[model samples]
Target: MNYDECHTVKTICGPHASCHNTAGGFFCLCHTGFAQLSGKTNFTGYGAGCQDVDECLQQPCGPHGVCINAEGTFLCSHMTPPMTSHLQTTLSPFVHCLSNLLKDQSIIDNCFTKRLQQPPADQFCSLINSTLAFARRMCEQKGEYRQKSASVTLKDVTSFGNKFVADGSGVESATVFLGAMENFATLAALASPTQELKAISSAHLDLDVRVIDVTNRRFLAHERLTLRAKNDTLDIYMKTVTEEQQTGASVVVFLSYTDLRSLQRGEFVTEGQPQSHLLTSSVVSVVIGNRRHRQLRDGVNITLSHTSQTQGSLSDWRIFCVYWNHSPSSSHWSPEGCEVIQSNGTHTTCGCQHLSSFALLIATSKVTPPANRLQHHGILPNPAPIQNVLQLRYRMV
Candidate 1:
């Protein structure tokens, strides 16, 4: 058939298409990069209805890739590296360290194996690994593993020389310092008698901890920490401790111990001297003998009371308290209003007059000069006592 004759015959096709005469009739063809909207590629209709093909809908790109649709074709390109999300930035440093460590197969296997010994192995392993990683990071960050470099300058030597009237004055000062250290060491050795008593006592103790925002004078969080004299090591369960109220606030923690008598020998609380540290920009941990203090923000106090069930009796327990402030200029610890309120062989109650970061030290007998006394007797007190109408008493259950 001639083209004109085929055209005269009412050939059917859709828009955006062309009609061409074939042997007997005409057929419709769509434009490039497009398809027949009605699902017909070649048609004997007057017009061939065509639409753009959505190549992106077919997902022609690989993982981490993007597809760009154009005319009748699509282009696939790799996506750019993803920006660090807020969640990643907010993740604790310990989590990052543990994630890196757990990537090792041997560590994972050994950890999992150890965890299997305890029921709920997976959960315990996770907690243990995370805590270890956090502690590791803290130690490294605090330079515990790094030797500090002391840079002595000529100016320092000159200053030292000028501070003294005679050439032997510097030597004299060094001698005095060494003598004072020896005296302190002797005092500490004399105080070692408590260890003998602690060795005799087999009491288990429970710590009731409360965090208070001293600036605002409000309670933030309360938690119970349990310790057994036999374990030698204790786990501080702090997963539920919330930190909602800790932003830019001075915090104080109160640790109340059950069976103060068993602890009186200073077995559980004598690991280190009172020290304060800023764990992070928003978190702080303070160690005072047997008690630990941390800052949290949420305003919820969880009070736990329980009686001692250990074999040993608490007849000889005495309470000793000390505290530290994080102020750079003055962080030394001193005793506050801790005094014996009531006492029995099984239990003892103590009262504190003020709120600061304090720990409860258990000893068999009271030590002279008080636990708050500085190594050097000349150091002045940093915290003054705060008076309150309400008396706070820590009763051992």
Candidate 2:
């Protein structure tokens, strides 16, 4: 039997469909991108015709970009560089400003106003070290490790005038610098630390001066003095001279300062004035001799010694003075002047049992007191006044 003759069937077109035959089975089908309308079929009826599917209507690309329909799948293309994220974009301005400030702050107008109250300590250390380095450079320019044993003489000590005039507190608080010296030359390298200074001779002349005010209080000037020496250790004779010292013997061995008596005392400046000395500690000058820690006797006048045997840069041979106060609170006045009197029912006020009662009040008289107390200063004269205030009275029947 022939296949065509065995099963012969006539196909009729239905609604919204095209007919296809395969392996003796016939089915209704629609073209690609079109859906078949189900059930009955007529030209314009429900299943009679295929509907044209709109690819753009679906909008599969989300809201950010455009979606293109291809043969089998859809292609999503960004309309613009994917728009910056709202969250990240919103913070861009803040990040930019912070980064700009971190760069050269010259453009920032309020940089100084926002500066920290105190610069880091490391900053001060760097500044001081730099200044020392400059001095070391000057030393290297002259010579290195010039040793003078018998009679050491130094010259040109005036070159380091500014360093010598620094305040005592600055010098004492400065980090100790240890310099690496050249073997033959006394001149130290700029990068090295400055520790012990070299001298020319064994019996060197040491000159020291303390600035004493009218009240007999002494202040220290810069402690490190410029001196020329042949070795790291020894005594050397030095003379302080200006550029003019070359022609004359005007090498001043000592600088004598006499305090001028000022009539101003206990006078505070007007309010709103800039603070001239905030956070700065009061500094005192202390003289140290051959001993490392021993202080020279008070009231001793330091002067220059005249001697014949001297050679080399005698100008830099000035005594190295050290600045220090007894303690951090050394500026506090000792409780000696003030007095306090206690009050009782009979006498109303009397001296307390302590010897310092009177001293406390006197010492504190100058200070603007925060409260009403017998002692205005740091010292307390008597505890009886406080006791009297605490006593209680009761009515009896």
Candidate 3:
């Protein structure tokens, strides 16, 4: 009988396919965003099922955004539509902290700002800690803001770090510096090309940005990011690795700090060595996405160069790769997750399981020696004299 085959047999079509009644017959049509495996437009038999069509291959997202394929759809992170609207009152704290850091100023400007309205010495930490607090908040907010860079020089950066360390503000410049790197990282990563190398440079700091395509490890030349300052260099390797469950565009940023020597004086990180000293005055900060607060299964390797200096004597110093750690009571450097891979008089290389601001420290047991016993007793030697030959790697957690 010429009965409606499409309506009589409710299960006429396979999943994701619809049965269309025709002249005394019925045809199967794949649903939107799906295609029949056989590539036939119309069919009556269930020989094939509908398959998800990868719209991303067609670049449906746009010109500026990267398309991410899904089971039946796709997504795009467009660089347009300024994320400023998404920011709320809660972001005020970050705005305040970051605005203070982005000011372009020379050492003289910082020193003579308002002779009658001088800021507290601890303003360095106060500003830095606030920015870091915002970074911690970003893990939850994932919000993006305006693009900004600090205009201070390496000399001024050194001066601020020293000022904070001297003020005993209970926060390390490493922590502050780390916060600032991620702060800029968030800005750079939020709206970036999926597979392109981007370099932003100014007098104060330089940044490298790369967005990873998870589907392709060799997506572009961005798998490694390197930043070079006047006399220092930072290399961030394996920027593509991320947690297995983590499924977002991985962005890597490598930053050079102004100066870390000031913060090193009081924030020694060696265990049981209260008098430990940082060998090189150089310190650097980096972040891959927002994973700085946790450890990565496949850790990232970083290489850093040390300052050049000639010393008359050397001591039995141990090299350590450390990151800044903060607590309610105090802030210090910690080498818990890092190990020295290689080191020389001028550089050190370290491998760390976490992602954070990294630096190198050389520790030697400090002790008082009487002049009478200088030649007789087993007295401790001088603190390790590390010349500019230094390269380092360190992570978070």
The lDDT leader among the candidates is: 3
lDDT of 1 by residue, 123-166 (tens): 43443443333323322433422111112211222232222212
- Report residue 240 deviation for candidate 1 (angstroms): 19
Error in Å for residue 341 of model 1: 3.0
Whole-model lDDT, model 3? 0.47
The 10 consecutive residues of candidate 1 with the worst lDDT sum are: 277-286
**Residue 41 CA error for candidate 3 (Å)?**
19
Question: Candidate 3: which stretches are off by over 4 Å?
Answer: 1-174, 194-204, 215-240, 245-248, 310-316, 364-397
Report, for every candidate in turn, its global Cα lDDT versus the true structure.
0.30, 0.23, 0.47
Q: Quick one: ranking by lDDT, best first?
A: 3, 1, 2
Of the pair 2 and 3, which is ahead by lDDT?
Answer: 3
State candidate 2's TM-score. Answer: 0.20
Per TM-score, the best of the predicted structures is 3
Tens digit of lDDT per residue, candidate 2, span 1-397?
Answer: 2233112432233332455545544455543334544533323232344543334358655664343222112223332232233433643222222212122112111222122234334543443343333333332322331111111111222122223223221422221210110100111110111122342121221222211111112223211222211111111112111111121111112211111011001111213232111111111111211111122121111111111222221232221111111223221222122122222212111112111100011111233322223533322233221111111111100
Off by over 4 Å in 1: 1-130, 133-319, 322-334, 353-397
Instruction: Write down the lDDT that model 1 would get.
Output: 0.30
